[model samples]
Target: MHEVKKDGILFHRFDHLGHCDRLCHGVFTRQGGVSAPPFDSLNVADGLGDAPAHVRENRQRILRATGGTDLMWMRQVHGTRVHIAEKGAATGTPVADALITAIPGLLLVVQVADCQPVLLYDPRRHIAAGVHSGWKGSVANILGRTVAGMISEFGCRPADILAGIGPSLGPCCAEFRHYQTELPEAFRSYKGPRSHFDFWAISVDQLCRAGLQKDNIEVQKVCTRCHDDRYFSYRAEKITGRFAAVIGLSPPQPT
Candidate 1:
């Protein structure tokens, strides 16, 4: 991942996606905004008890940094539902965990604190998706499901898709005390000392199982809980704001 500071706002761009001239994407950190502590600076989510005006301003800052004309965010219920982003879509948030779009200029976004924000792009088809996968969503195989959606809806081949797993809860801090009951047996192999699950590995495995080439996936591996200073961590702080992982197909450049 490459760190970029634009207009004083700091964010990250995956190397695989960064080289694509037709794409505009970012993994924004909680560094530049106007909100107070706990939700301090760059909190993009509107709910979660933050001031509405502050969230709006913060979102505007993000737009400026990403150069997106419009942003499409989901209600994010942690389910496998994937919404297709298109021009002139409805204003209300859709109740889904993933968003896919081929339309240029409509930025697809997923907000997260400790959950993994998986970004996928099919450079061949010029389509992109943003997925928000938490423990529940991971167990549900949201990453695989989103890839299937792209294949079905956009005729995108799995091998043509490039994926990036953004910073989230790493194994060092993802201790699941009641994994025997809370987590399924299939995830037992990922359990580490003291019951910490390596969700980053799990996401990569899910992507591969969905037919994506293993070499095409990039994992940021930057644990949010460990680096709470740069990102908001729900586990580390309990009360914190959400950062955004966004992707969009850029309009063609003038000749």
Candidate 2:
């Protein structure tokens, strides 16, 4: 992922999806905002103890930075639930971990802190999706579900889908002490030393198994715990802010 700056806001764009004029997507970092310490600057998640006004302001900043008309996000519950956003759809906060849309100007947002913000775009179909996947979400194979939803709902082919796994808890810091029970037997194969797990590999494997070509998936490989300076990490700080990862079709260009 390469960093893109807009209006003092910093975010990352997938190399595969970066040059496409039909879409605008970003994996925002925890920088340039009005919130105070702990939630210092650019905290977008609500009901997490941050002031509502600050969250609203941060969200607006993101909206402006990404050049999106309206935003669609959810109360991510680390489950396999997926929501489909359409043109002229009412913006309501649903309880789901993934949101997909083919509508231009409707930005799909996902909040993250020590979790993967998976963004998918199919240029062939002009479809985009934002997913919030943590360790629990990985276990549930939310990536597969989201891709399947796109295939069924939007006629998007998996091979044409470009996926980007944003900065999150890398294997270096993704330690799981209770893997014996918390994780299934199949997951143990991906375990590293000291009970740490490489979720990046897991996500990539999941995407490939879901029918996307290996080249189409891009993993940022940024560990939130290691780069807490630029990102928020729940493992590093229990009460931290959640950064934003947004994807949307660019508004129709003037004729």
Candidate 2 versus the native: TM-score? 0.98
Q: TM-score for every candidate vs. truth?
A: 0.97, 0.98
**Which pairs clash (backbone N, Cα, C closer than 3 Å) in model 2?**
none
Q: What TM-score would you give candidate 1 relative to the actual structure?
A: 0.97
- In model 1, residue pairs whose N, Cα or C atoms come closer than 3 Å (at least 3 residues apart or on different chains), thus clashing, are none
Q: Count the backbone clashes (under 3 Å) in each candidate.
A: 0, 0
Taking the tens digit of each residue's C-alpha lDDT, what string does model 1 give over 71-158? Answer: 8889999787989876677356899999999888778888999999999999999999999999999989999999999999999999
lDDT (0-100) at residue 230 of candidate 2? Answer: 92
Worst 10 residues of 1 by lDDT: 84-93
Instruction: Identify the runs in model 2 with alpha carbons over 4 angstroms from their true place.
Output: none
Candidate 2 global lDDT: 0.92
lDDT of 1: 0.92
